[model samples]
Target: MGMDVYVGPLTRYTLGDWLTVVQQTMQAAGREVRIVHAEPEPEDVITDPVAVSDAVRSWQAGLLSALGSPEGWTDEAELPYWTDKPDWDGYGGMILLAAYDEQPEFRPGTRRGLLRRESRADSARAFQDAPAYKRASSNPTKYPTLLSGVEWWLPVEVAPTVFEAPRVTGQPARMGRVDQLVVELTLLAKRLGLDDDQLGQLRQAGPPDSSTDVEAAGRFGLAVFLELAHAAQLANQPLLLDY
Candidate 1:
């Protein structure tokens, strides 16, 4: 029942933190990995699926182009940070792979090997192929985190996500399951000073993938959603209203 998974509200956490946890999890598992934002785009919060896809594609392209060519594809001295340029607001996090997980290598000009091979094309093409890029993260949960207290194992399923067959290696990570996560989150709420509603709000918003199959969605949905909500709460800090 345990299906290992990466957690996040892509916007909620820093790129470093997000990537760290993700790398750790996948490294423990010794498998190819992927992370999809609960909210692929800010607009995904609305019911506009079309707009969401378009936005995600744009971001996807810009990201690859930048990573593939850190000093600017066309040889510009300064390159745009992944945050603002290309309006990083679209999509959750990125679809990353742990190419050589042993030590989280920093190969020159090689950042995201996890992205679907096709998404690596020019930014425009990545956007146009939104559906495919979106699917890249749709993988059956192999290792999900334990929520806190649940006793039984719940298979981790992240549907409409990108996946690759896991290559079990040294110190392989145990899989994360939904049932176990339910228990963990119950405890997480108390530890983090979050009530059920806070957790519920987090749980409610999940990755935008209506086209995914039923099985994966049902399993890993809540775990992934909680991560997003947590991140969103951090990234979108509420403003005080002056009376």
Candidate 2:
């Protein structure tokens, strides 16, 4: 139950179903990697209760279409463990789930990817040089550029957090593996400073993530951490993390 969702660099056109691709890619080369889908949503949350439903449908379609493209960080090198035949350089992408007050609906489910025009464009630029602004300023069409779109609400758990959002509906998301998810989120325990007794209390008490009436608070604590991490990134702040 501890988890945090993050968006990272990816290769051009390597966006759709990347969880499977990354999993299979790592496994084929005998590397252990953790990846998971982090999408948070209330089964029936309506930001504009009247328009919430319509927005949800539209958001879902946008996410699906966005995922079809690819995400990338063309500037960095791949991880040391990367043995995949294809060079992992300049490959980056992002999947945004919801910022929920509860644990994601399930271990495996869809969440939201809140994409504001500014944030979407900002993220996309991380992938490719906005050709027009290149250092050379010569080849305009030589647009060695990356395009960034966004994924909206994906279907998943109906948590209490859903109702708390300024606009309750859907959000952004990510994909990978169950193990990676646990590690990604649990690592924050160091920052959370949970002692043995404190851990117990967190699990037993604290505010729920919004969905399930009751679940250990510690589990959703991780989800909250994940949400905060995303908020930081979208704001252009240091991502407390990105592993």
lDDT of each: 0.28, 0.29
Local accuracy of candidate 2 as per-residue lDDT tens digits, 75-160: 11121111111111111111111111122221122233663222112121132342212321222111111111211111222221
Where is model 1 poorest over a 10-residue stretch in terms of lDDT? 81-90
User: Which candidate tops TM-score?
Assistant: 2
lDDT of 1 by residue, 1-243 (tens): 112232322122212232333445678898755544432433324234344344433543454353342321121112111111101111111111111111123211334567433322212112223332233323213212321111122122331122122111111122333333444444434444556565455335543343433222322233343453343233332110000
**Lowest-sum lDDT 10-residue window in model 2:** 81-90
* Model 2 clashing-pair count: 39
RMSD of 2: 21.5
| TM-score of candidate 2 against the unseen true structure | 0.22
lDDT of 2 at 219: 41
Clashes of each: 38, 39
